[model samples]
Target: MTTSESRDEAVGSGDVDFDHHSLTFRDHPHEALAELRSRGPVLHSSAHDGFWVLTDYASVFEAAKDDARFSSAESVGIPASGMPFPILPIESDPPQTQQLRAITMTPFSPGTVKSLQPDMREIATELIDAFIERGECDLVQELTTPLPARLMLRMLGFDESTWRSWVERVHLVIHDRAHDLDAAMTAAGSLLTELGTEMERRREAAPTSDLYARIVHGSVDGVPLDDVQITMYGFLMMLGGMDTTSGLTSNSLLQLCVQPNLRQRLIDDRSLLPAATEEFLRHDTPTLGLARTVTEDATMAGQSLKAGERALLMWAGANRDPAVFENPDEIDFDRENKRHLAFGVGKHRCLGSNLAREMFKVMIDEILTRLPDFRLAGEPVRFSDAGEVHALRHLPVIFTPGPRRK
Candidate 1:
């Protein structure tokens, strides 16, 4: 058989070995991906225990777009034991996915998020105030984590009382092993069930202008969304909004802190914040990659992939692909044409991307204006193990507390 045919058969059968590579690919994934991209864009690998990884920009993007050709129904990587429900729209497709997106999109629109900006700014400033007083703080805990959680809670009309528990549950759910997975999943499910019931009650008794009420009572094609769908969507929104943005924020700050010159530049000229955000995202995409199962035999970069095989669309690798990005390793804040897959590509692109960009803009603008010369107090811990989300576990920084003007 031809090389392409062999690779195709491997991918089609979900027969790639995943154990050869290191757990996180922390040292040099870009270089490895580049080698794969050059040799064969869609090569099969039985690494990381066993899973097919699709490396390269064009092929990964193509796989992501053609959902029909690459199904998401199968257990992608390792399933969380005892979690009966599939992880929202991420694990779903077509009509159901579209319906869920429509309902969830209402609260995350530009207008809705823009309206919440003032409140977000206030919260950001409050956190900054505390950090400034201390002169040193952990950015992840003090700033990044809380900001997004608060925004998500407010958007969903959920009580702040449960925020800590919910956030903890999510972190554990994502990071913990199979033994702890059941408890984590149970906590998340129970929390959502309560929230869903409360949402339904509010919808019936006094429909509010909040997102929860809207989704609980909303309809698509004259069909009202069921409780499970609403709850799942809410869970997704909460998870998506909190973790990814928090990761982005912490990663951005970590990058800025490490690169003193960039920090000074942003301090001197706040106009570079937008470009800086893009650079940070491209350099360290929050979500690493998404998984897909091949549905039929197909050719990718001259390699034929067969039916019912699993493959990972490496967004992180694609973002760093030299063919698409100039000087992919260098962090160019002033990049003229930034087209990174930090938020993904194609139809399943992150729906909250616009909101995420705006959030970063606002948060970064506030930080530049306040703590301009922030420096790292210690080494930042990168969360490289969360299969798809890349983030920093802790980012300790020291800075002169800027005066609270606002």
Candidate 2:
């Protein structure tokens, strides 16, 4: 067979046409990714709106690290122009990006995250307690969705009463492309303005120990942050802490429920939570891939990319590339060199990765301890669009409640 034919056979599955698939790439893009990896570490696909999708782990890592050559200034999603606003740090490159990331990362350091562990566990338990008696509950709604939102609100000093509205606004911003971008942008802008005002009010009244205060008064390079910067940081933090954690928690729970043997093993040995979390991230990262523009003409994996052309660093595809990960399809909790690009790589690696890991660790530990026998209610599954992030619109499950503690 010709090289192209072999590559096509490896990546192609009759379930979905790579040429026509949009929004929802395929029922199983991972299978296609594996096939592509076999044919060549990197191959341009008709997918991703005809832009090059990098499927090899090493090349994806290289692209993520070589930010000078590949710029992140473009829109993250398709259609390019309609995104409401540039996701600060994420959409920025170089000096400005570095400064913003430094400011944001300060409040999310390992110590700060560790300090919040007790609070996170308390929140998880409180949510779990509410539903434990029912013996059957949708873990996504009951636990996964609220835990991160509540944590972020508390961190930012926002009222819990407004969590639902904020969640809806973020969802609309991220998922509802049908809605007018102007309207969504206006709504998000107004919401952040309100948040900023509230933050300023809190600062004037009495300095409070919270992320909002830190940002409102914090400085980068001897210059304090302005209202706009503070607002952008607040909105970005809220969205980042909310959606990604929710998606990860829901996805991990689904995996546990479906794999009874794995679930039992985890329950028997709680120490496995951290490794299991890493494996889950490697297996199915929430954010699929990140985009970057070629700053200068460059060759990648033997293909020439022109200046100003866009390329996708497929994190999900990379994590599953057999070239770096042996038996990439399987979820091996004990896999050595568990350095997965689920958190991206280089300067743009997620600042909240530590917090995310902690959140997942706490929630998974609590769930396995309290609901060891948790099982799916009926084919507990995920949404159709597994593109940007592998999220579950709904994850229904049934579990035998654990023994009541004194």
Candidate 3:
């Protein structure tokens, strides 16, 4: 159908020409999101070629779980990335999605992630030591960004020295996509080249424990994955492993910088860090949300949607619904039902959740113990647009100069 027809069918209550990537939305999403949610559970936005916005807990939850009617096969980004290859598992529906997910499941599995904690802690320590005696640092560049990238490289058997390049490429694609589509596409192409080259190398070598080797030799129903499929797997892994965790960690640290009491509380009782992590995730929601296509003519949140229409499941909105969580705007570590949709929900839930959580706790623990007096040296710089991933580009912080722990 034409874009006009799509808009016509989407006309209903709660209608607004909402653009999640808009400057207004990025600068003040909480206020904008609250206004959107107050309109109704679902609203039609004549943005990104026209799509419905699922703004409440029930509607977002229902749509996310019932993927049959609300499909992910078409695209997950509001304005699609326009990549040459499909983003596995996330951008695909069932069967193929499940198969692709299974191939990478082992590396991101809870058990596997748990085993990497010591290394995670060591990386955090080494990163802190790099600038501990300097009295100040940019947390995003010095710590958050590299920690995940280095870990991912270690898992893929790639040299960790190239972590900065990997981080830049992934960040360019994710944080720059909204404003600079061409740059994002170019970064994606570069990523594909690097990943493709590595996959080729793995193909000629004997299978091993690294994630690259696994994907290179992996199969679906006994059929070996093609080079394109392997590259896509690598692409997805790089994005998943690097971006969201850094965003979540950096956002949480920003909170501590602004809320001294919160920092002191966590320092006093480190156990509270885990609960605080959940609350931070619920409030900050690094991933914001993902997009889905209406598979068949369906009614959701009392709104009519036609097949091929797009709907954005706003996790950030759903996580703050008053009906579900008390004082939804406030961060409550004591929240009993911390079942927030930060990592998302249902079949497409984040596979790296365990690792992300562990990484967050470890980073927070190290920071609190060593740089307990750290405070913001300047305003944190958020990404230009946060439609796909909510992130900070810089977090300048200062503390009493200390000796390098390592």
Q: Clash totals for all models, in order?
A: 13, 1, 0
lDDT of each: 0.72, 0.74, 0.87
- Between candidates 2 and 3, the one scoring higher on lDDT is 3
Q: Write the per-residue lDDT of candidate 2 for residues 24-111, one digit (tens) a residue.
A: 3535667767666666665555554556667788889888898888788776554353544566667778777788787657668999
Q: What's the CA RMSD for each of the models?
A: 3.3, 4.8, 2.5
The 10 consecutive residues of candidate 1 with the worst lDDT sum are: 13-22
Give the candidates in order of TM-score, highest first: 3, 1, 2
lDDT of 3 by residue, 104-153 (tens): 78888889999999999889989999999999999999999899889989
**TM-score per candidate:** 0.89, 0.88, 0.96
- In candidate 1, position 250 carries an lDDT of 84
The sequence of per-residue lDDT tens digits that candidate 1 reaches over residues 320-349 is 888888988888888875888888776667
Where is the poorest 10-residue window by lDDT in model 3? 1-10
Question: Cα deviation of 78 in candidate 3 (Å)?
Answer: 1.2
Evaluate model 3: give its lDDT: 0.87
Q: By lDDT, is 1 or 2 better?
A: 2
Q: Which prediction has the highest lDDT against the true structure?
A: 3
Give the distance in Å from residue 273's predicted Cα in candidate 2 to where it truly belongs.
1.6
Candidate 3 Cα misplacement greater than 4 A, ranges: 1-12
Query: What lDDT score is found at residue 369 in candidate 1?
Result: 77
Rank all candidate structures by their lDDT, best first, as comma-separated numbers: 3, 2, 1
Which candidate comes out best when scored by TM-score? 3
